[model samples]
Target: MSEKLRDQLVGAWKLHSYVEIPVDGSEPFYPMGEKPMGIIMYTPDGYMSAQLMKPGRAPFAVNDFYEGTLEEYKAAGSTYIAYTGPFKVNEQNRTLTHSMFISLFPNWMGQTQPRVVSIEGDVLTLGTASPISSKGKTVNSKLVWHRAQPE
Candidate 1:
């Protein structure tokens, strides 16, 4: 991978959009709701983390994280996604892979997913190369992010 691309990815990006296009030609779905919010950060040391969620999610009735009601737990689980791991860039193919070391979705733990990547100025676009099962449908996920500006 070129150092330039690596350098470009080593920063924080705020999610602008996240859409899942089904393979069966159905309407696209927004897993994190219409106006989702997220942040992904890549470090120079090859570490990365991403946190995404639906906006305006209700708080659990109980303040304890592990003592929420079943409905509250389900709501929280269905509305959020988070993972942290190491990342690798394949500059030759303009692709990037994130190997999950930790993930809220247990199934994704230890899985390595590849994404087709492109950068234009401050926008970073990532598309899943393979369809992933979501909400009982196979879909390709596309996410757009904007580079975070220094405060």
Candidate 2:
């Protein structure tokens, strides 16, 4: 039998990328030397959490020279967005919908969005709805989560 979506996602995975797609078909958001990274952990008790580890400085285009040291960047941890709620899969659409009753992002505190999740071998890809930044632009963030192997 094919593995259930829930079963495939029940584990700890690291983030690979976090992109922002522009609404006007302009250049999508890509970090400078952008090594977008993060982590996601889904529990058996209908609980899920995620954290995004991003580069602190781009190629000194806007903010002059890179001020922070490499050690600082490495030490400057990532932000997290977690929630505890129910999750269901729509096999027909190949989509996984998560109903987050509580979330770290205040906006998602009481909202649910249909997301696309695909698992190929050990890689888990997740696509979310258009995320609007403070400037009100629609962007699709593609987050790749790699399964963490037990040591």
Candidate 3:
């Protein structure tokens, strides 16, 4: 039986992989490096949160959150992504839009981003609706997620 897209999306999904495809067709890359870890969750109430991190980040010499050196802070910022906010689904085309109430990257804090979404079995694949500059290149982000199983 096929369920509505919204219904299918109301749950937690673990990150399987993430890739960025350059519009110029130069090359696709993974910003978080190999084996990135993350989770994206959607609630029936239309709220959502996503967090992704690069694997094996170096431990900060200082234990305090605010005590990291510039290099350490830069590494942390470049390796982690997080945002939480409300999301809306377009019933006409079954597309998704996420509005960031709070984001790790300040520029996205007030942005509403569109996502091209599809689901196959337990897999959910999300792609950027439009190209965006990333690492000095224009690219579309593709994130594949698998439905989380309860432990």
**Which candidate ranks first by lDDT, i.e. highest?**
3
**Candidate 1 error regions (>4 Å):** 1-3
- Per-residue lDDT value at 23 in model 2: 66
lDDT by residue (tens digit), candidate 1, 1-151? 3357778899999999999999999999999987889999999999999999999999988789989999998999999999999999877666799999999999999999998888999999989989999999999999999999988
Candidate rank order under lDDT: 3, 1, 2
Best by TM-score: 3
Cα lDDT of model 2 overall?
0.68
Q: Work out the TM-score per prediction.
A: 0.95, 0.70, 0.97
Positional deviation of residue 93's Cα in model 3 after best superposition, in angstroms: 0.9
State each model's CA lDDT, in order.
0.93, 0.68, 0.95
Whole-model lDDT, model 3: 0.95
Using lDDT as the measure, name the better of candidate 1 and candidate 2: 1
Q: Could you give the candidate ranking by TM-score, starting with the highest?
A: 3, 1, 2
Per-candidate RMSD, Å = 1.6, 7.1, 1.0
lDDT of 2 by residue, 36-105 (tens): 5666778887667765645553332235336766654444422334565777677666677777787766
